[model samples]
Target: MNRAINCHVGCRCSHLTIEVSHGSYRNFTQRFVKAVVNTYKDLIEWPKNEHRVAEIKNGFMYGEGRNAWGLPAVGALDGKNFVIESETVHAEDWRDCKGNFSMKLMAVCDDKSKFTYISAGNSGRSHDAAAFNLSEIATVAMENHGEYFPLDGYILADSAYPLSHYIIVPYPASEVLGRSGGASAKKKFNKIHSSTRKAVERAFGILVSGRRFVSKHIYIKDTGDIVGIIIAYYILHNLCIEMNDPVLEEDNDETSNVDVARPDSFIQSVNSTAYQNGRIRRHSINPYFPSQQ
Candidate 1:
């Protein structure tokens, strides 16, 4: 089983060497992915307790440097689009901004680039903010912010995400580019936020570049199987980190860039309590950033 998994994930023409027929090889791969994902699903969950949360926060705070942003961030959040063959049902929904048929995998990862949580199988046409808002983590966080994100812990995200008390996003381009007095400080804050939030992007990069199966356009017909394969990759990604496996360099130049597509317009509702509180929270931290001369 292990050999089959390794061969399938690591090689493009894995069926050729597996000794099994092509159909059998495909079935085995699917079954293996499903089993692995089901068995190790806990490996990709949010922090269970306050102590675990603190540990993740400490890692993010001191991993790159001493309290890199002076914020208690447990992880970084982002979305990654996996290219797929055209689907028969809802095919247009699977088309992304780049005109490719794909599915989006929304994920969060710690400073060490290990995936802590993931919500897969969303259509690629969905925006990052919309996908995140509909995610289980978002619902949980909104219902009980203290349970999963205790001690004021939050995750860093890009401007493509909605700013919430538990999800810190960068200042909008308008705010940072304005001629106002605090513009420089906001810009500085954005720069630091981007640097810290890139861990999620790196995690996606590692997943795609590390596995041959992930980098190619997945030809699977069933969306559930595609989701299972994605989850399996994330599970194995964390396992590799635990086992201290060296991350493979990107052999394909096209896969080197892993940034998600940003929406043309992001409207934050000021009437929402979460949005107001998020703004206040960001304001409280913005002044701490020293403005450039």
Candidate 2:
């Protein structure tokens, strides 16, 4: 492969052709990368053990006083934008809130900076909350309801996400950005929320910093191809952590759930009751917290 790439670099073709020896270097590189990614994408599985969920919940609770924000959380949710160089049929949909042309990669990572859930391929224009709602993880969480979440445990996210029983978000801007003497109570909560959510940023930093391809502008035109590449990056990211791959630096040692069953109507009723209970529980923790309504 190295020899073929070297040959391609030596030869000057007016137009790069896939018919070259083993195809052009760019073509071969894309196929080889995607092939490896597809083969190992299964490695990026979400932990389903209740015990592991408990461990994560416990870890967050113990760390709350210092960094976790007092929320019994199993993961921190956030999103990253990736630039796509190829023009698409719906080019306008690729524009993000920041006015940049890109795609969104939404993910949930644990305290250790390992991703527990990821949903990518959303157009850049899609809001973080909207992208999350459409993710498979969200669908699973909704379907399983009480069975999925650990007791009193929820995921922590920024204000960009809607607050629910299973997910906690920061106080609203009105409370967090209040006048000098107004609603000072929410300040502490917001501080904790921001502090805990910083883990997601660190995770993205480690991911993009470690993977050169993700750091560079992605030129793939096909949405599926882009998703595969991102997933491939994630698989390698986790494997490196598991095997302690040395290509990553010491500091970068990086590298970086559930079931339920019930009758249709009965399950829906149970889910509603669970949601109400969760709301009450949240209120008990913070009476000033805003209601989802």
Candidate 3:
């Protein structure tokens, strides 16, 4: 426990480096993390029960004013890239947009900055939209589209995602440019979206800051092991939030840049199944309105 706490408190400390260099501590941390994560699987679940989802949505509405476009938003989704240094069979697969070897972790968090859903192990080379399309959350959202948000509630996502009833993205500036009042409404919506979405960034910051193993480039060889460790961290992260653990302040200026989600051309075609489904799904939901509405 002390070692894990120490790792969280000061991941870059010389003491940890020395212990890790000696071999035993590294093995110990791996076993310890795995044991704890496996033991507490119940704490980390996605698209929680209806009652829990409602409670989480209420928290978002309370913290971020009930804006019409995102009033019933229960979670914010974002992807984070973790650098890895060891060579693997699929090294090229893990190469990211930033030209680094990495693994992409797509996560959705509530207002409290706790990860409600995290899908890890996607090749960093995969675009955020592509990764999300293949994620379990997307499958669940589609399967229970009506039940997920009967009253127009949706998860907040960036523009990389196709806008649908289950997910909301800010209006593209170009779509509203040169029209009177269009720009103002677009600006207002973006502000609300950005503010609400910042919670995910904060959650990423807290995770990176607290996990020494992740704060530095992970020197593991097996992709599976690397992924397992990351899953453990996500579980631990949520546990911290549940316990009301004090968050260590991160150096905001040093945070890694969020990769721009590239729009998948195939999915964007109007005739494509994805685009058509998205349009149809969006129409099925009640129109979103600002809190005042």
Ranking by lDDT: 1, 3, 2
Better of 2 and 3 by TM-score: 3
Q: Return the top candidate by TM-score.
A: 1
TM-score of each: 0.84, 0.72, 0.78
**lDDT tens digits, residue span 125-237, model 2:** 88776788788757787567566665646777765655567776654555445555335545665566566666667677777777656664665566776776787777778
Q: Model-by-model lDDT, in order?
A: 0.74, 0.63, 0.68
lDDT winner between candidates 1 and 3: 1
| Candidate 1: 10-residue stretch with minimal lDDT | 255-264
Give per-residue CA lDDT, model 1, range 115-203, as digits (tens).
99899989999988889888987877667876777777778887678777777787776676666658878777776677777677777
Which 10-residue window in model 2 sums to the lowest lDDT? 253-262
RMSD of 3: 4.9
Error of 3 at 280 (Å): 8.1
Which residue pairs show backbone clashes in model 3? Answer: 68-289, 68-290
